[model samples]
Target: MSLSGETIRKIREAIKSAFPNRDELVMMLRMELDIPESEVPDGSNYNLVVFNLIDQLDRQNRIPELIKGALNERPGNPDVQKVAQEINAIYSNLSDKPLLKSFEFDVVTVNAQGWKISRKRCRAQYFTEDLGNGVTLEMVAIPGGTFMMGAPKNEKDSFDYERPQHEVTVQPFFMGRYPVTQAQWRAVAALPQVNKELKPNPSYFKGDDRPVEQISWYDALEFCARLNFTINVTTQRDYRLPSEAEWEYACRAGTTTPFYFGETITTDLANYRGNSTYGNAPQGEYREETTTVGRFPPNAFGLYDLHGNVWEWCADTWHKNYEGAPKDGSAWINDNDNPILRGGSWGNLPVLCRSAFRFYDSWAERDSHDDLIGFRVVCAFGRT
Candidate 1:
């Protein structure tokens, strides 16, 4: 779970650039990693001190956590931000690609009866797409696996559309680490149009890091098309919305629970309306607006905003049920005008945010967009 040496070097450079003063760097590390002041390696040479601290954190498998914390703590520091993006891109272009690089994390599971927390580990390969202007998109590698795709008959508030609990075999692919952000949307929007024009700023909640909402399914497809045209010169993968089966497989992250974290969700874990309770979990804050991506914890596969933040657009057309659905994880398309949406939004009740829950845009209109909807992109596995 140790970060690659190149990643360490980039991080060190970013740290040095962001905090030139040795005392400031040490203090930032202490506060970010919760390391005691006395425990920081004592050295007059700043580089050695910083290297020692990074080495210790890497050995503890906290490098990902450290990078994320650093970025969140100093959102304005372009140097630190670039380092995070570069590190993710570095893994993809290495001469000797290490596809097995792994990480460890803790996941929570809750139910009407009670709650429990446990440590989980996963191996992932990821690459960052540089969208220009210091904006980047991190795409995590989801390994191929088999999983049941729908809710069981006895699950609480389960829907008929999510029925029969069929098994689906999904192929490995790369998924955006978080939903597409406003900065990323603007960058991609600026790219030469492939099919349709794009509005640079469509999100109601305005932040560079916040997920870009008010996007139609057609708009999402165009974003992927434009991105594919830009990135395919070097990497031949196609960028597109994930198939519904792949979305559920990745969201579940090897779990069968109603949600990735567990049987029920709490507002503490997502951005949905928290005034309403789910299972035994008590009612929590209802933010009523989108929050910054990565503000909440990720699932086991290192994906964020899978359960909430905003309902994500999926590739499949609307289907009444799992009956005759594609078992091979391809998009289920058949001339249906309505498109599917998953992973409920900030304004939705907790029940709608379950991993198995399903929603569709208005049947009459295919061009609809709103603040409650956004999407992440996926790249084919072998092409990269």
Candidate 2:
């Protein structure tokens, strides 16, 4: 009846404001909500009507197109902005994790990587999972496939460490739509500890939707453990830091470029020091601090902040090369336990964020939090 604390009502209001004279649209919308013509909508009841409509339309593949069209027509219009924000807000609040599966985008790869020929894509399928406590995580379901791991030998920025371009077959996995945010971090931190106790708020730059930083690899693991504990009780799925292979494969989506978006890296597409440029791109802004997640366009996988924003932690220990790495997507564990990190941070050079670029830190210093490092989680399906 409350419609998840009035959020549904806000979304409806936003939508109505965006399209003032669409009686035909309302007909479908009302039916989606299952609202009888005789029922008088009031207060929270307004949300019930809207939420019902959203669920029904989503299943019928009717909502995303309409929402996208309306928002895209006037993305900067105040009313349209409110509509997009409200919808995104609801997406972030649903407990089951509402995923907007769209096959409406195209795949791009570097000249070398594209030679192998990968699957075609239409839309970047995007989904979000609720973590309770009014917190949610957005994710993109990456279709499993085989791709060459590391950088190709002739890539403009290729490095020997990323060379020998080995083949890696990754299974389908749900990766966070964006890096973990302060709000999400606080929500999970409140959960009972799985290994080490987590500080409820452990970020350097404070913003609700900004990626949570200044956390160590151990902290990232603890978040995954506690998350899996709560999520698995019902879903029977495990949550953990993605293995290095999974991280790269997902970051690249189906692209073979220096960055998933294209051959060049720009601050406009990500949050990073803008004084430097890569490829033919020009230098841009230096925000000096992290920006809100999802501020930029998503890669083909419907993933945001993959190239920059924060250097994400990976499950594998630091490896000098992939000569003997696992071919089947499992993490390569090592005795030293030096943690592997990828996706470069807001303060890093553009080159560091390149898809094959790799770096590490003394994993023993799990508490050595830095503003440059953060992590995302992978929800392992059919895995308990």
Candidate 3:
């Protein structure tokens, strides 16, 4: 093992005190250490020299007795005992430190050209979580950036709530590739509670990869809390729901269009109603029921089902507009109903599936949940 420079210096001092003549000390230590002449440097390799001397002294089995004698002569003299401790510490550290390991994975993204799978670490674009129990969650690494949030004026069927569009700066984080699937939700819900208990299979849909719906806003929070605990044990950090601004920022993925792919979205690109069309795009097929997660293409950030599939619950409370919204992407929590839903569901019109769309579940009926609304998870992570 390589010894610290300071440790080497202290070792040299010990050797010098033991033998005053440098040449004589070198000859004796070289023989005792069994170090070849080729390996010995004229002045350097003092660390090695010290290490061997300690080993030889230890083999002689006199260090403990020496410390005992010194303590009896002068309590805590820090002479022989201190030197022995330093030698022990240097050796101890060699066995204590563990080697670091590395891993690699892939993700998919969209651009002006089309969807492309990437294994490159270009934006540090990577997020793959295995929640265990036959349930794994895929996510995309969202690089932090500033963007103009909310639907623009003159947009088709844009609501007043989406009006007064404002800019938001979201920090880098990992967002689920799709809405929380039944399998993912069941796995998290089965974990031991942190603050509250949960029903393992709360979704109205019965499929594993299908999005988990019919869950209350409070239930979503509980699921996240359980997920936070589970992931924290694996990575020593927790997960959370994305703020409304963060959801919008990641959903846009650098696009100002109504959808991440373009000005209009179709069932081929998303899972929203197929009979209707938006912008100048042609009408397409609409599946009346929830489709499997990742049934369509992903956004530029490699996130799927952000525009449709299921309405994702955001951590923000219901707000009218961006008049006094937060600039940095953070949950705008209030005492009122604390859940804000975004991304249209399978039963909604294409207009409601716009990237800037927003909705909220009924607060008066906490237990109420429709088949149209479900949520995904987000976490502040990755090398920043």
Return whichever of 1 and 2 wins on lDDT: 1
Clashing pairs in 3: 274-285, 274-286
The numbered model that scores best in lDDT is 1
Cα lDDT over the full model 3:
0.67
Order by lDDT, highest first? 1, 2, 3
What clash pairs does model 1 have?
none
TM-score of every model versus the real structure: 0.72, 0.68, 0.67
Model 3: residues with Cα > 4 Å off, grouped in runs: 1-124, 361-367
Top-TM-score structure, candidate number: 1
Candidate 1: tens digits of C-alpha lDDT, residues 222-249: 8997675444423445689999999999
Worst 10 residues of 3 by lDDT: 94-103
lDDT of 2 by residue, 213-308 (tens): 988888998898766544443343467899999999988877777888677667657777778777667778988989899887677777788887
lDDT of each: 0.80, 0.71, 0.67
Q: After superposition, how far is residue 287 of candidate 1 from its true place, in Å?
A: 0.5
TM-score of 3: 0.67
Tell me the deviation in Å of residue 242 in model 1: 0.3
